[model samples]
Target: MSENVAPTASAPRSLHGWSTEFRATFTLAWPLVIAQVAQNALQASDVIMMGWLGPEALAAGALASSFLMPFFLFAAGVVGAVAPLTAQARGARDIKAIRRIVRQGFWAAILLAALLLPVVLQIRTVFSWIGQDPALAARAEEYIQIAVLMLFPALGVIVLRSFLSSFEATRVILVVTIGGVVVNAFGNYLLMFGNFGMPRLELRGAGIVIVLTNIFMLAAMLAYVLRHRRFRRFNVLIRFWKPDWPRFRELFHIGVPMGLTVLAEVGLFTAATMLMGRLGTDEVAAHAIALQCASLAFMVPLGLGVAATVRVGIAYGRQDREGVRKAGWTSFALGTGFMAVSALCFLLFGPAIVTIFLDPGVPENRHALALAASFLAIAGIFQLVDGAQVVAAHSLRGLSDTKIPMLMAIFGYWLVGLPIAYVMGFVFDWRGVGIWTGLACGLAFVAVLLVGRFAMRERLGLLDRIRL
Candidate 1:
């Protein structure tokens, strides 16, 4: 087996000069941003298609998807540990090390998916335990059960994509995602509407489409990686066919806490979605639309955050502390600015955005629209902070300081954010806006702390402290 070697280190400097690092950052970040956007679009399509099936279907899909979302978060975080490692290796031009990391990451993702199976299998029971209208609960359970089958493929895709991403090979993800979205949409149309002699499965049909789409995406990514000359010659394709226990252990060391960190953050939103179910289907439906809108808007910052991770990772790999610091702050500034524009758009046309997924004429629909609009309005208020915190987290991850951000997510979301949301939304009956207001507070806290952490680390020359 060919070993992956690390890239050679380059001297670090400020961004003042016409630097290779600045050019490299942009070169890598743009394609990554595009790929992230495509993936988000695919996810958004799931919500949109289900929404077209009616409010009940929308509510069921939202509940089911959100319930399963934390698992994906965990999986993504685990896979994400590969990127920084790969990026550092790439910076040092260690093709052998990169190949080894990719192989190990693949196996780690498979194991992580397996470990999550039992938890996913319990999703139905967990939802019931949370207490819901029996009918909606049943629909949610059915959708979730089928969706569970997708865990393997979905996790595989994350691992493969992250590894490839570190090499600045992002176009593969974009191609696969675009194709997957098309497949998902077509399948959803056929399965949901009983088109072209297909059996109509309603909510279950939507889940089936999602599963198939994920499988297709996994296959596509694998094919691309195997066929690509860069990866093929580097021996990543052949190496991935074998197991590497030690490398897997290293991946787990980085991945597990990263998973836990993501779980803590995403789990909060999952909990919020469950809480919405208790407020009636209208509330749940409204929340789903608002969530979708917010999620779509979030793609901008999310893409930037992903880009920031690569930038920071590359800089860290070269041991350029100054470059790492600048990359992070630059991405944060860019993300914040982008989200500010989105927030303004959402504020001025919040109702119109909700209308994309719902009709406002029907009585119940009107109520859903009103609630969703309220939620979006509040969500818009914190878009900038939300972007900042996510970018900050990714930047820190690039620095390989995953633990602190994990703890911060726990404190900010659970101790501070959720309680406030509960008081304002449920206790005080401030409704959707109150819930979002709490989310904003939590996000703001995360933003401040993460950025502060990065600043402190830079000032203390912490990058040198962690260099391998």
Candidate 2:
């Protein structure tokens, strides 16, 4: 392991009125934001297209997505470990370490994909237990089954994407993700409604579109990585081989807990959707719209989090403790500010926003819209905290302190968040707003705890341990 590097022996510089460090951080963050936006657009398009199939189809898509999201938690968290490790390697100028981290990430991705297969196969049973409508459950199960089969290729894409992100080569993600979005939209149009002589598979067709687009994205990303001279020089894509047990262990040490943390958080929302179903079809549809909106709004902060991981990892590698601190704070400030503006928009014009996904002319839809707007209003208050937590968690990941954050998220979301939501949504009959309020509380706790952890780590000179 490369550790203990001296900082550059030079004076700090300024960029316009901003510090050079801040400017560099922003430079890294923008591509990530754009990439995230494009990805969100693809997902939103899916929801929008399915909405045209009527409320039941839309609800089925939501159910399918919620069921499948936890699988991504595993893929995402495992692949996510690569960035910090690679960033540290890059900071140390250790090409060998970088290669090792990248290879190990690929191994983890494959293992995770294999592990998820059984779970995906059991998705039908899981949905039944969650109390989905029999008809909706069948549709959701079909979509999820096909989508799950695509996880193998998707895992490869995520690993490669993580490697590029660690090097701050975020533009690669932007290009491929935007391309995927365009492809997904066209595929959805042709398949979902059977346009241009295509068979109309409806919900199942949408799922197929998602799977095909993901495969195309993986191919595009791999082609770019293989053909690009700069990437070729990194030697990340040599011969494929078996897992290196030691390296795999190290990755698993960090990844499994991180994956569980993500699962816990995502699972809470998935469970919320299940709970919403018990209330009625309209309620579930409304919740789906709200969930989609929240997920879209979250992309800004999510991008910032990815950027923070790279910045912090590089700073840690350089043993620049202060630089790590600055990067984390800058990311938090940028992410929170951007999301806050979005929150205000959601609060002030939530009805209009809901109209984008639901038809107000339908009585059921009108009720759903009202409930969705209410949920959005509560969710708005927590957006800043949500952004803060994600960025802070990413910063900590850069420092290789993934475990504590994982514990915090699990306890905060499950022990605190879910129970509160359950009481409010079910026991107290506070309905949707109650569940959202519970979510806010969970997110708030996570934000406070993560920020505190980051600050403590910085104060203790944790970043100095890694040498670049």
Candidate 3:
């Protein structure tokens, strides 16, 4: 928590130097981007394969996934503290701290899984209560139940991923993720379609394949960490089962708020998805398609956010204020710029993009396809603020400032965003467009607040005190 005097002359002092930081940031961020895209591709494959089964299948998967992913993100967020913790430790040349953080991260993952398991199991009943279609709810329930089986391994992968990514060893992450995508796509093909002499399981088959893929990914990540020559010196696998209560508590302290922050943001989006359901199947399916496209575009910035956390955490650990500033801003620039380009793609080719998810020959889907294209256009407009806010939030995470930002997310998403969405969609009768408009408003508020907070921290010289 103590601040050292600013580096006298060692730091870059000009825009040229800032450009160097941006280049370095991009180098670190692009692999993470690829890894994130690949992970999303896994889900996209699920949606695509499920689409082949029909709209109900797609809706069922989307609905169940909306409920399940918040829990996943919460667990991952809690465990994600490991990345910043490990990165800072590395920067400080404290291998023991790195080992301790990773070890405790596993404990955190276990506790979170135990706590979330029951909640994960009850989604079917919850869906019924929410007035979703009985048949759709039943299918969603079956899928959710099977998907719950993957939660433990999925979390284990999150923890291990944080450890691996902090070391900037993202190549292995990408390779494994690519493999997972292939495995999932192939598995879905065999199971969902009743190929290879198997009975058609449809939705249930998709869930099963997801579970299998998660297990394989966890196993692969564990194997790489345990035996890889690069990771051997850290002894990450040694004493692999020992309990460390104090560090576990520290991780929990950092992680719970992180989880809630993620929950606040993801929950808002999930809530929007649910609300869209009330507008009818066409609206919900269209929302899902457009959201999927937006989510894919989102991965680029999400990767940059991860990069920001590592780069800023490392700088923070070394007490290099300038390095921290440069890292955060460079990541923000890269993230926003990329999203701007993505927004252009979405705006210019939304119909073409929407077609990728829909079977054109299916007359039932034409309305949904057209609606999804419109949603994509709205999604494009929001991309700028969305990218900025997420990157800013991650930058704050890298600074180990989690709580205040969590509150900001709650305020932005719930107080500001949701109300507007409700009034516009229901009160004013704007429907799906109004709902997305509210989302844009929420993201814009969050972006402004978070960016301002970072700027304030820099201007007020409060970074060190906040670290305390």
Candidate 4:
């Protein structure tokens, strides 16, 4: 295992000037931000290609993705517990604990991938149970059967990526992920279009590309971490087969709620997708385009949220109250500020953006294209809150405080958001637009509760529980 090493001088501190804090946060954040975009691009590239196969392919891709993601994100969130655990260990300068926590994180990833495999392979059944069109469900099943295999490599990548982020060596993360995006695009082009004598398997081809891209990313990240002088000494694989029962339990302790927290949020969106599906193929496809655009923009805050986890976890481990406060709020401010710009971009350029995903010149796509533009306009409304909620939820995770936030997310998303969506979308006969409005409200609701929880951390003793 790596030895206890003090944070480098460049690490953020409570005593630093405001300008220093901003610079420190930005320096830590920019690579992660780009990496998140590139990570999403792996799928965005697939979406663009699926668009070429026409609306049916695009809608089926969206259906498969929505069905797959709630499970994928839940499992990844469990493995993602590594970031806060490793960061706090880094903060307290505990070499042994960091190695142990990370080892268990890997174990958790492998176990989770195995457990979820059978469940996600049932995508077609779930779609049928939920009353989706038989043809769409069957096409989507073709993608699911292959794409679900990515879970193993994807979760492994998250484990390693969390470790890399803790040490602030994120440039390689950005490089590896961007490389995955490029490779995935190339693979999709060859496999999906029969280029270079390859078979045109369409959605199945896209699924193969997804799995291969994730495996390449996992392999690349592993190679770098193993060879990098700064990380190699950790020897995380030294006892890869040994079981540390307590540490394993601790991973589930923090990870399950984190997983459910992600599930609640993703479930809301997935449910909305189902509702759109009920409305018709064009509704679902348009929802996919607009949602993809919003999700791409969302990668910014999601990156900042990752950075906040490390920064806040470090301070929490050191028992530096002021350090934790500065780190959390600074990240929150930066996230919301960036979203302000994105909101305007969505409002102003939504039609232009939608055009990139679907040709405005196509007669067949005109209705879906117009609907996507309208959905983007609504997506613009929730940008700030969407950004705010992620940063706040992650900041609390840094405190090793997740259970309450999990409940809060459930309340806001399920009890609050889904009910609204049903009423507005179905009861009100508003269809897709009404469904999206509920999503915006749910995000906004979670943002308030989480940020307030952070603001009250001291008063609530949320900051007093550190025992690493």
Instruction: Score every model by TM-score.
Output: 0.85, 0.87, 0.88, 0.88
**What range of 10 consecutive residues in model 2 has the weakest lDDT sum?**
9-18
Cα lDDT tens digits for candidate 4, 1-468: 111223344433355656776787788889999998887778778889999999999999999997888888999989999999999999888988888888898899999999999999998889999899999999999999999999999999999999999988899999999999999999999998889999999999999999999999999999888888888888888889988889899888898999999989878887898899899988998999999888888988998998999998988887666678788999999999999999999999988999898888889999999899889998998999999999999999998889999999999999888988899999999888999999999999999999999988877888655322
Which residue segments of model 3 deviate by more than 4 Å? 1-5, 8-16, 51-63, 131-141, 191-194, 197-205, 278-282, 351-373, 459-462, 465-468
Expressed as tens digits, the lDDT of each residue in 90-169 for candidate 3 is 76779887887888888787788888889888987898887889999889988988888788889889988888878778
Model 1 shows how many backbone clashes? 15
Candidate 2 vs 4: which has more lDDT: 4
Report the number of the highest-lDDT candidate. 4
lDDT of 2 by residue, 315-420 (tens): 6776565567677888888889988998898889888898998888877677888988888887778888988899999988888888879999999998888889
- Residue 464 local lDDT, model 1: 58
Ranking by lDDT: 4, 3, 2, 1
Instruction: Decide which is better by lDDT, 1 or 4.
Output: 4
Per-residue error at 187 for model 2, in Å? Answer: 3.0
RMSD of each: 5.2, 4.0, 3.6, 4.9
lDDT of 2 at 447: 91
lDDT of each: 0.79, 0.81, 0.86, 0.89
